[model samples]
Target: MAQQQWYKGAVIYQVYPRSFQDSNNDGIGDLKGIINRIDYIKSLGVDAIWISPFFKSPMKDFGYDISDYRDIDPLFGDLNDFDTLIEQAHARDIKIIIDQVLSHTSDQHQWFLDSRENTSNDKADWYVWAEAKQDGSAPNNWLSIFGGPAWQWEPRRGQYYLHNFLTEQPDLNFHNPDVRQAVLDNVEFWLKKGVDGFRLDAINFCYHDAQLRDNPAKPKDKRQGRGFSEDNPYAFQYHYYNNTQPENIEFMRDIRALLNQYPGTVSLGEISSEDSLATMAEYTEGGDKLHMGYSFELLTDDYSSEYIRTTVETLEQRMTEGWPCWAFSNHDVERVASRWSDNGEINPTQCKMLTALLASLRGSVCMYQGEELGLGEADVAFEDLQDPYGITFWPNFKGRDGCRTPMPWDDQHAQYAGFSSHKPWLPVDMAHKAQSVALQDADEHSILNAYREFMAWRKTHTILLEGDIEFIATAEPILAFYRTLGEQKMLCVFNLGATTASMPLPLSVVTEHNELSHHTGSVNQQLLTLPAFGCFYAQC
Candidate 1:
């Protein structure tokens, strides 16, 4: 049999380009900035770096609204800079996975512009356009994720086009063979550029229901999850027809076929639907589809041992043929340190414990930038908010600006935290400076050092990386699982609470060696004792 793929259990670090660093003092990070910080990323011991969108865009929804799929945005850098970044990152043994927002493009894109011009235009059907209802309203009740109706009127075409996100981002018609080929050509462009893989953005949203069906209204209680607030109208619907269409499965096969031509290239899809876990499983299951898939399941306000176990186990049971990728935080949601902590405060121990738990999960991991320092969500004021989603929803949601703030590199660089010489697009939170890389590098017990140590240690354990996971039933605040591969078996347990807790030993195993040194827990006779937010790992 062929050997397991490199990305099967790899750790990927996500870099939000605009906030990672500002090499030119432009208050925004660029490709050059990522190249400058490539060594630092290497020090994290990650197998790859998944960069958020840096493609040419109108910046309406940041880089998620691509105007030119083949070019780099001038605000970030040119193709030369990207080539240099790829070279530098590969020199350090780190792979590059760029975000592919294939579901939509900025209204300013050539295809969208042409499609919007006239019904007879060559690209007229490239996007989802429909005739208005007799009452001159949107054809259906679909709503934009950014709020308001999903359909936007184009006077020239005299029809409303579908936009699942911002009105500026018109959904591409994957039903069009030309559109599918064009999107694949764009993917091939990046593949030829030598990127190791792609982090397919909204991969499940590529196709819409052909019948233009109206999404059923979700009851008030069921409307609160997947990063949408109860106040946002997008959360009011079941989101069935607008995304996760049945045809997306075949499109996934086409994408996988293209990647198969490029040996060692991988595809990691982002799936969010009414039942994201099941969709994630379906997208990654056949091996002819996505190599790995992740969802917003763990990246929610619900944080507990039971919740985590249920989420992981549910996917494990459903995903019998495909691998899963897990993440706790990303550029879109609140950082885990504050989101999971008591009273929204930063807890270094809890951060460490969560890191250990995530790494020990059954699949690969994606860690966002600044997670190593246990950074909390920043408090951006109303006037300072740049996220359109936050501006539309206001106080209750606050968009994603808090999590997109600049990374703190030097605690002593009081002005900009060493992120930029000038003011950043968003201000760096003062609380983050105290836990900067410069300060953490000097302290052995700091979250940054602990993360580095644990990641480095994790690389040596094959069982932890490629084993079959089986959860052991435990009470609240205590998560226990065993990872066994071949003749090797390792027990991973964590105390996710604030107080010390003990549980009967799941198995009779003496501690030959413990992987983490910063832990404050121990395994005693027929019992496992864990200090608050402590974790334990040992071979049986």
Candidate 2:
């Protein structure tokens, strides 16, 4: 067989800097801490690590509001420490993917400072700015995802500046060629540093409507989605004029051109749009665009078999040339173990089953940091909440802090569960302490071990890595699919329900390999009985 792309069948682990591991006795996780755990990361069988932003920031929206793309923030350590980390990771044959937040920057950024100073400054058009209406309201009906109008009144230039997120984060004006060149230069700095790839954060927001037209209102019945509360005004609009502009695709082409100069380097974009699947297809449809793109469809609360299958099938139907990356959980959402399955209330069979299920799918996968350990969502109280979005919605929506808690490493070193000796930036859930790596290391069937086992076993199946997927028409609780390559074919059957499900074995196919793992039910000559959360993997 010809060699497959390195990303195919590869699992990318996301490491949120503040929550992964802490060194220097500071409450925050840093570069040295990641270096210290390189071996641990390698053991999980993930191909690459996607480290979240660690650039210079004012900490308003954490590191997402970058002030300097070239400099490492003091909280995450200096550039030398990052070099050590890159070297260590490379030595282990693990690639490094850094998060690039090119859409916006902190208001403290030097370019924004100069742009806000005067109308005729050299960097005056570096950010999105417009004249206020006669009524002194916002420039248009654009709404910020964080809340309120997207426009922030800037007294410096006596105009309103567009901020899709926190006011401190001002969106860059991609309409200006100079701004686009500057962003490309920032990425080139990392490419020169020997980084393998990048995960572009909110790449679609790089450009917006040049006319500054007001966004149209959405139908009240279809008002809640994209990780926002139904009551949030941001959810009430169609957002046509504010974002998802046609110009974004050309900007992606420019990014692709720059990346082409760096061989072996790839780009992945995170897109959240009205029709994420369509946007994902559009963003990655050609060789001149993103290498792979992932949408928020799989990160939602809908866990039905139909939803999962349709979401994948819909994208597969629309996306002819684009490759996909699937992820169930991330830093911004609740943990999958808790969201998809009952937490401590139920056994971990479901978590292990999901792991195997995701590994057997068609696309590349992204694993959240603590997912291998079967970590559940942390229940952060209102008093300990740090996310501004959470504070705005309050009791109804507690925000992303629940998913951003510190990683638990050991039991003996439980001062903050070995994450940090000092108090962690976010409270470590005592519940997760019982599920630490040290404890799970001794258990053969732990979720962490299951992940390692399945990933290792997955390498033997060439079809699973690079194959076309076809889902068989099955019942509500059971999901069955076949993956086929040139001459290699495998059948993957899963039971995602709580009750036992059964089906007659198809006489046309033969089960050549009995590789079924984590099995609980029986498969006689004629009938296949699947227990709750059971999975069947075999060669046909």
Candidate 3:
């Protein structure tokens, strides 16, 4: 078989730096701490590690609000430390992809600072700024995802600036040619520094309505959590004028052109749009845009055979040449084990089954830290909450802090669960402590061991790596599919329910490898009985 692309069916591990490890006893994870763990990460059989933002920021939205594009935040160590990390990660044959917040910058950023200083400044038009209406209201009916108006009044400029997120994170004006070039230069700066690629954060929000038109009010019945709260006024509008403008496409082409200069470099964009699947297809439709894009399709609380099959099939139909990266859990949403399974109490055998199912999917996969250990969400107390989003919507939405807790390294209930000498940023859960890496490392049947074994087994299957997926139509709770590439074909059958489900195959296709067995029983003839949450992979 011919060699496939570097990213085709590859597994990418996501590292939320603050919770990964702590170096210098600062109680916060830094670049050096990540460098020290490169060997451990490389052993996971993943192709790359996508580090969440480490750029200079005020931490208003964690690292998403960037104060400087070129420098490292002191909270994440110095530039030398980042350089050392790149060297170490590359030495282990692991590529490093840093998060790039391209849609906006912190209000504290020098460009925004200069733009707000005076209307006549050289950088005055670098950000989205508009004059208010006669009643001293915002230029449009746009709303911020963090609540309140999307427009923040700037007294110096005597105008309201656009902010899709926190008021501190003012949106950049990609409509300006100069602004687009400046952002591309920031990407080239990192490329020259030996970075592999970037995970573009909110890449679709780079442009807005040029006319500054008012967004029509969205009906109450139609509103859902596409990043806006139902209680917040932001959820009342269609958001047509504020984001996902057509002007953004040209800018993507320019950015892709720059990345093309580096042979092996790739770009993965995060599309958090109202129609994420459609936007994902648009952003990755051609070779001149993103190499791969992921949406929040599988990150929701909905867990059914139909939901999973429909999502993959819909994207497969919409995306012709574009590639996709599928992820169930990240720093943003609740953990999958908790969201999909019954209150996160999935048995160990089921966890292995789920891991195998995810690894065998059609597209690339992203595995968050602690996922291999079957770690559930940390039940963070209200008093210990550090996330502004969670704090603003507390009692109802407990924020992302539950998923961003420190990684458990040891089984012993030591200080910070062996993560740091000082208190961790988020409290570690007692349940996670029991499932620590050290504890699972010794057990052969542990979730971590299963993940390692499955990943190793997956590396040898070319059909699973670059195969075409064809779903087998069946009743609810039984998801069956086949992955075929050239002459290699494998049938992947999964039982998503908690009871035995019998699936019959066509009699004519039965072969020597037709034996179907789960953790419960064996199969005979055309009937295959699958145990609760059981999975089987057979060569036919």
Stretches off by above 4 angstroms in model 2 are 1-4, 342-346, 512-516, 519-521
Tell how far residue 218 is off in model 2, in angstroms.
Answer: 1.4
Q: Provide the clash count, candidate 1.
A: 0
Expressed as tens digits, the lDDT of each residue in 331-362 for candidate 1 is 99999998999767788899998898999999
Evaluated against the true structure, the overall lDDT of model 3 is 0.84
Scored by lDDT, the top model is: 1
Task: Say which prediction, candidate 1 or candidate 3, comes out ahead on TM-score.
Answer: 1
Candidate models: Cα lDDT each: 0.91, 0.87, 0.84
Order by lDDT, highest first: 1, 2, 3
Clashes of 3: 1
| TM-scores of all predicted structures | 0.98, 0.97, 0.96
Positional deviation of residue 262's Cα in model 1 after best superposition, in angstroms: 0.2
lDDT of 2 by residue, 230-282 (tens): 77889899877777899999999998898889877888999988888999999
RMSD of 3: 2.2
Alpha-carbon RMSD, candidate 1:
1.3
> Which candidate has the top score in TM-score?
1
* Model 3 quality (TM-score): 0.96
